[model samples]
Target: MASQTDDTDRITVRLAGREHRDWTTYRIDSHLITPADAWQVTLGIPADALPDTVKPWAAVDVCLGQDVVLTGRIDRIEREVAKGTNALAISGRDGAAVMVDCSAPIFTRRKATLTEVVDLAVRPLGVSQVRVEATGAKEKVEIEPGMTAWDALAQACEANGCWAWFEPDGTLVVGGPDYTAAPVATLVMRQSGQGNNVLSLAVTEDVSGRYSEVTVLGQAHGTETTDGQHNIKHQETDADVPGYRPLILVAGDCDGAAEAKRRAQKTLMDSRLEGFTITARVRGHRVSESGKPWTPGQRIQVVSEPHGLDATYFLMARTFLGGRDKGSITELTLKEDGVWLPELAKISGGKGKGKAASAGKVVELS
Candidate 1:
């Protein structure tokens, strides 16, 4: 279990099924946009305390108190010995690291389901368990010879309006966030120190990759039996972009106008993911109210008078820093709203209907 005080939280690492604690410093970074979470630790122990013989590539489980935060293999280990000091450092990434580094299975299947495609991408990588929460009609799936496992899974998931990620226990999950879920915690920043729980908060607004409009042009190839030629295209506009900046994309996989529109919409969502970001730094690795470790994809309520923010934000990423000078700290990366919808705007009703702009707006911290 993680030992927690009012100020800081403790961490433990189980290497080859043996638990070890008392690290001098550690940093665990987890995020939703990235492929995998990363972790590293430094141990300041005496020469005689280095009794364990475990080397690099050993299976490891990192826990924040009782919750397993990361499960993977150690990637590197470094040892330093001074005249009177000895230090050891270990670093690794979560199970998704393997999927990001290794190539997926190269095959083509006609009328394949999401589960079948996910199986092809993960099974060869030794990821046995898979939970696909989203469903879609069967479609033809083709993977190239050198595509990364993460890329293969992403392509499959995006077609179904879902995303793929690994759980703490190494289970591959294919699903989308439930936007209706309640906020887990409320973060407050007051002028007086009495009611303030946040150490520091920062917001960043970027529009480099963001576009005012996106157009996807695609051509449907004729089958062997037929020689029909068709041109398919779709366009989406971003209200957030004030200028006339436009982006044009060519999608070879688009089958029709609908597919092309989805592709264009996804581009807007990607822009929103990079447009605005909020960073919150707080003490302890866990939330004070829930007593649970900070996690990605959870909604958090923000109440900052200085920033004039009294809205809910989504937690896109969080980093846990232990053994710092002040105490254990959690740095949260937040988006304007939780979850990145392909439209980047709320859908009102059915197909061909206009989308309503999102309630949240990008705020300039300056």
Candidate 2:
């Protein structure tokens, strides 16, 4: 009976238009920076219970309850036999898998809008739904040979201090978190063991790649007719870095001094991301208060006096696990808030297409 209940749990996977559950083992992994969400499931059953039509490359939809969470295609399948019972396992990635695996459509665009770049990179892969919520000025970018679709899209978005990720329904979204939205749930780790919902909270702090100061230098031409600038530099300091460890990088190119500052700030944030992370393990797969799965890019309040931690964090990754041997578990990977948004400049005036003044330099490659 317990095994039957486990197989009929709320999570289900639809393949080839047929919903399937009763999984003997399952794992789902999703991340904010990763292009694709991945999932795997295995089952041991009589050979007759297996579907002959279910094969690799078949379209799949993963869902919790009635809401879909992932739209992807199967990548691999394995079959094994032991003691006259056959076990079948399959693994796959979401729509962005193609972007990560295939080369981008080669193109050189002049003064390209962010949305345009995203469409150019993903549409060829049969992903026509793309949204760019993060604001940025029209950029002159060249997507040369050998770049993957994901690389091209990420480069254009990251240059503007934004990121590209897929929505549950397979729409590509280019934006940062909506900081104004309220936190969905609070994880309390009280020393008194009262009102605590957290099963385990682990904090990791490493300073190996962290630094107090970051300098970014670049060179670039202003426009088609204007002269290019050289030696454009910007430096940003991180008060969080307790010691004076400086790092400098030569940025390949910059739109101006403004872009230089943005680059420097992004570097500093990257250091912060590397320096600290919080991992929380909790019972069940959904947020208690919201009834929704714990999702990446959401804000979560964490109060743990034992670790001297009392701040909201950005959920950057989440994983769900459950099988015959274990109950449902959700593991959350979080980072300090506001560090994910890189704060790149956006164009203003005249439909947000106007170019800002060049403040830095764009370095040329030899």
Candidate 3:
């Protein structure tokens, strides 16, 4: 058993039927707003700490006291030989990572509901259970030729405004954010170095993800006659954004009018709120208002005086780092509304980019 305290949570590592307790360092990275609820863990120890009979692909389990927090197979092992003693490092992600490497069957012209398509794609992978929330319940989906399982799942998630991720126990869950739910708790962060719950704080905004207008174009089947004139037809939709910079988006090759319109509306609606992130670190393992240890994907209210920001935000991602030297700290990456949508830029490149040069241009993924 591992030790547990009010301000600290102990983690136990088990690999290939052996328990590892002398780890020199460890870190857990969990993405709460991603399609896979992806989590990556790394553990390091002296080389001699390894059991005599150890090999790659061994079953690895991470636990907090008696509760299993993560279960997956180890995919990487590294060794370092220094002047004195060597060190070993191991890392891997959860089961959902496997789906990224696997492929799904291609359906040339099959029509099925969104739920049915998701079931057919993931069922073969031994995904214990699949639950798609309200938004995608009655939607019809088509599986095109040569679509990977991951693509199929992403398609459904994108259209329905939902995210897909596996539970720690390997259950596949697909759902939208519960905006109506109550927040976990109010975390008061003061700028003063003393008597502040937050050790550090950062706020950022990106204009690339914001758009002032969205234009969608879809393919129209067959020709139509208007006033005795034969004409090729097409579907189009447009959305005007308010307050955001005048960036225009042009999306083409949509399946149909409805699909084109939905895509345009969703892309604009989800992007209305600019990308604003608040990153902070808090000491100890904070228990949320929900009575559980703080984790990502939960809503929380934050009061930061120096920043003049007081609002409810979604805990999008978190990293837990703890050791004998630094005790424990929970690092949080938050989104204003906790919406699981894509961002314009993965990172803020340097500060030298000319603002005038980037104005009124659609930001495309490279």
TM-score of each: 0.87, 0.87, 0.76
Show how many residue pairs clash in every candidate, following the order shown. 1, 10, 1
> Model 2, range 10-117, lDDT digits (tens) per residue?
568887657777678889898988778999988887767767657887888888767777888899999998787788898999999999999878655444456766
What tens digits encode model 1's per-residue C-alpha lDDT throughout 94-206?
A: 88888899887765433445676676777888787788777553545566778888887777777766787777777777776654556789888877766889989887778
Deviating ranges (above 4 Å) for candidate 1: 1-8, 51-53, 107-113, 137-139, 225-229, 324-326, 342-366
Residues forming the 10-long window of minimal summed lDDT in candidate 1 = 347-356
- Order the candidate numbers by TM-score, best to worst: 2, 1, 3
Candidate 3: global Cα-lDDT? 0.58
Q: Is candidate 2 or candidate 3 better by lDDT?
A: 2
Better structure of 1 and 2 per lDDT: 2
Model 3, C-alpha of 135: deviation from truth (Å): 5.6
Superposition TM-score, candidate 2 onto the true structure: 0.87
List the pairs of residues colliding in candidate 3.
35-164
RMSD to the native, candidate 2? 7.8
Which one wins by TM-score: 1 or 3? 1
Ranking of predictions according to lDDT: 2, 1, 3
Candidate 3 lDDT tens digits, 66-164 = 555666666677787778747676776666666666776655657666687676877876666777654535655566767777777777666655567
Model 2, runs deviating above 4 Å = 1-9, 107-112, 221-224, 342-366
